[model samples]
Target: MNVAWYIWLWSDGSALQLQQPIVSTTRCDRPIEAVTAVTGGFEVRAFLFQSDQDNCGGGGVVPISYVAGVRDGWPVRVRPTYGPLATCDPQSLIVPLRPGGVVQLRVDTDDRAPIVEPAQKYDSLLVSELAVSPYLPEEQRGDWVLARAARGKELICGYVRMDQIL
Candidate 1:
């Protein structure tokens, strides 16, 4: 079995952006609630895409997580996946958003896995949809000018070396 995983960030109701080339990694067993504080009354979503194959068969899975804040802004949510190494194709993950909030996505892999390609050894992390307005009509029901400012998208990306494991 082989699989590739990545993270995405969506904000301000614009389009879901990709956050690749992750620069850091952290482990948290709790739901992310901090994001609500940052977005006011926006929504957050996370997803995992997986595929596998046994000597006699094949299988795959795509799991999605969505959390909505009651008022505005919630907390950061973190989850983990368990399985064998899988190959990730280019543009395997996609995120959706409206447009004045910020969203960040990241991907990590087990360092113990044997490298099929040296270039693939690097884990890609991307950060997108930073500081914008929601693309939703309700989000823009108020002041029109302010609404336009809120409806934009921003993104970032980086990488984490295996030797820097914490």
Candidate 2:
């Protein structure tokens, strides 16, 4: 687990495999607490370090509320069937903007304005989304823009790597 996953909150019906309750140099001592039975599984309300040996500096506690837990069926691990974030293509960042597109908009606010640099010219935006132009010879269709929300809807009409899309 990376440092980003420091505060682990599980809302499902499964109990986290945690460090044993006993204090030892090998594992955290009683780091799990506030175990409450929810609709499905248990929701931990508190997690503390009972001993300084666990790196809590003696009674260090990270409250469960401060932690970011799954919101519904929380902690959803979506293995993208397509896009730069695909399970196998970790090296690929050129995702097409089509249906099942999982890449996020990386709009850079240059002086609080949208930077319109060409594709691959800027590092802030995705290569696929920035691959827009009126001169390039046409090819297959580009990726889809699925931005449905309450209000202020927008779409990215641009070029995309056909091979990267579904």
Candidate 3:
């Protein structure tokens, strides 16, 4: 199945939307330079996925929330919105990391209240990636170090994968 995902970034009360067109049948891994250019001091990556469930139908946009933070260091305290029809649990947005240091992130849909499943043929699932990242400094660019910095700064470097069921 073909999936289309839109990646956006929000920081310091500002939002930077990406301009890259992404499509994936299985998975996608790419840099979100579009947003980093404006943020100018962080790194973020987003990954979106399509569920294997069957489609229901009643189509409507849902709100998906993305949060990131140190695993055991602190609680995830970031909320980004994705989709108008997506719904995920609050715990899914937690970022998990090792005691020493690591960046972990979680994405989920925020279906404010609970309601019976829609009669639509489309299935509700989670589609997400790392999030958005702030632009990184030249000296801070490296292998694992870059990833660490991006995570530590709470940068957004993730993407979300959305599938349209016909």
State which candidate has the highest lDDT: 2
Model 2 lDDT tens row, 33-69: 4544454333434344433234633333433222222
Tell me how far candidate 1 lies from the true structure as C-alpha RMSD in angstroms. Answer: 19.8
- Name model 2 segments beyond 4 Å from true: 1-26, 48-59, 65-101, 104-166
Across 1-166, the per-residue lDDT of candidate 3 in tens digits comes to 2344434556569875433322222223222222222232212234333233212231112222243222122222233522112223322333332223222222222122111222222112222223212364534432221011122333332212211210
Estimated TM-score for each candidate: 0.18, 0.22, 0.18
Minimum summed lDDT over a 10-residue window in model 2 is located at 81-90
Model 2's lDDT to the true fold? Answer: 0.28
Give the CA lDDT, 0 to 100, for residue 12 in model 2: 82
> How many clashing residue pairs, candidate 3?
51
RMSD of each: 19.8, 16.5, 18.1
lDDT of 1 by residue, 89-165 (tens): 22332223232223221222323322222232122222122212245444433321100111124222212231221
- Which structure is stronger by TM-score: 2 or 3? 2
Each prediction's total of clashing residue pairs, residues at least 3 apart in sequence or on different chains, is: 57, 5, 51
Off by over 4 Å in 1: 1-41, 45-47, 53-60, 66-160
Candidate 1 C-alpha error for residue 41, in Å: 6.1
- lDDT of all predictions, in order shown? 0.25, 0.28, 0.27
